[model samples]
Target: MTSPGLPDLHRHLDGSLRPSTLARLAREAGIALPVQPRFTPGMGLDQALACFSLTLSVLKSPDAVRLVASQIAEDALAEGVTTLELRFAPQLHGGAPPAVIVDAALEGLAGRGGLILCGLYGEPPDLLSRLVAIAADRPGVVGLDLAGGPLPSHDFSMSDYEHPFAAAREAGLGCTVHAGEGRPPAEIRVAVELLGARRIGHGTTLLEDPEVVALLRHEEITVEACITSNWHVGAIADPMDHPAARWLDQGVRVTFCSDNTLLSATTAAREHELAAALPGMTPALWNRAVECGHQARFTRS
Candidate 1:
């Protein structure tokens, strides 16, 4: 099938660093890549997360970062993705100020899509506050994403994101959280009830719990469902195992996304193709997913 012309709402800036560009940037910076980063099936989330260490080398310079953003935007445009929400934690880009990296990325995505700046969980509280302020000030920043992995421990006493989420809400920035992908379904409820997440990044585990699925429908939260990345991130054993189609059937709002184009060597077209192969795949369901994505996209309005 051809590209679905759907909006990709969960692509990550660091994850979209093209292999060719990575090689060029690494050669220019004298940094070496680690074993060609693609999602080897069965790779755990920790392993997948470690791949970004190599990408960080390429992202050290403003020009390199800008190049990545521009290339990703152009790639999305070519693949019929008109709306995008490229995300990345700015502090991870080798000590470059968050604002500068975000600015460069915004310039690359000029007139293309709005940015969703991420603040990784357990990040320094001061830096988190600074990122919220920066996101509030940046022209194309439409959301503040609380992104990180390993889910909260079972005891779940960390309050690191509370103040930041409150501040983001106060500033009128949309909130999305990385939860229920590698974590329990309860995390999704925590994100919505406590963290003010209107969208759940991944949320693969959500189908296992009907209550959470109902909560998702009740709260009107959107899920950024990335089929290929699920294999990479250890969220599912196979792309066929993705619950996006199921989520849609359950009346849960969902949109197909290429979680990491470069990292997964996949595209929005590829993601749509995967979604179309799901058990209940139908033209009507596909159209609904596309419309859900369009409505949920973070426009800098």
Candidate 2:
């Protein structure tokens, strides 16, 4: 049965693989997966990351990219997703240029009959020019995102990288950053004031600073709220206590997302379910949250 509301706007293409698919790929490539951990009842972050790394390691060719992207689209279709904006850090997939990776992934989405928006992930300073150039060339590519684990020690304030953010704006590509996922709210501020981010990914820490919250609300910056992902990554201790719900209540434009479905063992529908189960959550509020996602979609032009 398909869920009524499943507009998955913030999913990682590499992170949406089914466990069985991952296993098949591992076996096919002769890659040894690390021992699965029992952190939760039926899921383990270590095992998931290991599988993802192995999959990326084996998926070094364009054919593998096509296969994986096709599988992702097929899975989304089965889940009743009418619109899916799949994000992936092409730089993570070695041995191919970003364009080749994106093109192969888009090829897989062919005949799916859904809106598919592509994005560039991570903070690759040197690849900024190439990324902007590619986005300029590809109409399917809608946005540029700074994702992955926080590079705390890396200098993110460089002007060269900021130029691409500006370039994306000029090129009509939506700009977003994975700020305040595990970092401080100041990072979120920099993403807006310094880098000109149109959307903030996992801005869970926004509630910590009232000024930052006000700024986000004032700017109408949409926060891509990934509840399960934040919980799994220790950004929040529990889904019930997640600040995203509070952000929504306070007029902050927050939208639900599945940041890394495979890693979090979640889907967009599951995210909605979790939000519904949260304390003080109501059906009306849940619907409003989902609607917010539709408006905040990167594919909305």
Candidate 3:
């Protein structure tokens, strides 16, 4: 298990819905999921992402959103996670209004931590601006995140998100970007330089570029590492190849996280164990990694 004091800084609430809850919500909403919304080993990233679409279909109401968010917090607490930031894109939930969705999630968390509103890579600038506006106004919202997957579908450049991210920073909102999961290492630099990211989500390939690693250390940026999720998404073929240990040894801060608990079929306890087993990940470095999560948290209590 993770230390009871550890914080998961990079979870996606939308993708972490429990299987039983999903079935009940889908049944009540009269929505039929094409595939089971659970992750299995060996599934590619595309397939895992597709499961999120199925999860979103049933989360069309504020009540549904609230229930899922609240339960995720409860589960995290039950698993000994003292702090967690659950991220989700309000724009993707077609049923409820953005503010309503934000409120529902905040209500759900009930002060366990806070939400990190996401702006997807392919979304329009105006939409991103609106998301930033929501983050600015809501104290329950702790940060702004650049999330979404399958790089081929997103045609926009990193600079396209610069304005909204800058606005987020101006509003005192912490900024994080989902980069270097499957994209080239260069995009991670773009995320930091252009988007003003203070944290990086799924920086799986960060060790590939020494310069980028140095920049992360110089900038004091935290890297959110999701070990189980990386393997499920084929980001790393073998768990031993993960860069978490190397990053720590090289001075880049890393916080182990469960990116999508249900979608990755993992929990904080499981993630902690997996990270602890990685090559070169000593007990001291593992402990420091957990400490880094608390340091990197956007929601300061």
Candidate 4:
């Protein structure tokens, strides 16, 4: 079971849609369900994102997004996740204005969890700025995230995001960025120093640089580690080799998460189990990791 009070701070709502939900929504919309993206071991970044695209194809309307959001929350609660931050890119949902998408998702969340609005990589600056604006003053909106795969330019610098993220911070929203997943490890430093991220999503390459790890520990930045998803997406060669436990031992806060529950076919509980099985994980360390997760939550008292 997911440790009670342990928070999942890095879930992607769009990628967590249930197969049954997808089928029902497809039928209701008179849209055929696209071919399921088969998960090959180590399918790599391009193919992993392709899976999310398939799920997005079914979510054509805010109502559809709302339904999926509610169901995903229920599923998380069922799995014993006491707190969650379910994130999604509103701009990817459809032509509906971002506010509409945010409202639909917030309604579905129903106070069961907080929402993190995502600004996808490669999205136009104007669209990203609008997304940041939409997050402000929204009830149930606790955080803002920079997510998605690498842009064609392979640029993951903070230059394009600094202004909007500053606006996000000004609005009192917590900031978390998807850095070091497949990007250069230096980008993780940029995220914390420039973008003002308090948490990092899928920091797969974090341990590659000792300086970066030290910076995170010094700043109390949490790393959202998705073990199974990392292995499946080729971010890590093997789940056992993941450095989640090592990070904890090194004094960095770490949290286990199921990045895309449906896409990775895992759960919050399973992620915890994987973390526990890592080489340096002790019972005390495991408990501390759980405590760190609750500490890292963006929701305010």
Specify the highest-lDDT model's number: 3
TM-score of each: 0.94, 0.87, 0.95, 0.94
Give the winner by lDDT: 2 or 4: 4
Comparing 2 with 3 on lDDT, the higher-scoring candidate is: 3
Given candidate 4, what's the lDDT at residue 67? 91
Q: Which ten-residue region of model 4 has the weakest summed lDDT?
A: 149-158
CA RMSD of each candidate after superposition: 2.4, 3.6, 2.0, 2.1
Ranking by lDDT: 3, 4, 1, 2
- lDDT per residue, candidate 4, 204-259, as tens digits? 88888999999999999999999988898788889998988888999999989988
lDDT tens digits, residues 28-58, model 2?
A: 7787768422123223333334445655776
Model 3 pairs whose backbones collide: none
Q: lDDT of all the models against the reference? A: 0.83, 0.70, 0.86, 0.84
Residue 46, model 2: Cα distance from true site in angstroms: 11
Model 1 lDDT tens row, 1-301: 8754778999999989778888888888887665787778778887888888888877886788888899999999888897788888888886578788888889888868878888876666667688889988776888988776744442223266778888888877888888887678998988899888889999989988899999999988999888888888788988898878778988999899998888899998889898999878788888898988888877544
Candidate 2: what lDDT? 0.70
- Winning model by TM-score: 3
Give lDDT tens digits, candidate 3, residues 81-175.
88799999988887878988999999999988779999887787678889988777688899998887536577676788889998888888899
For each candidate, how many residue pairs have backbone atoms clashing (under 3 Å)? 0, 0, 0, 0
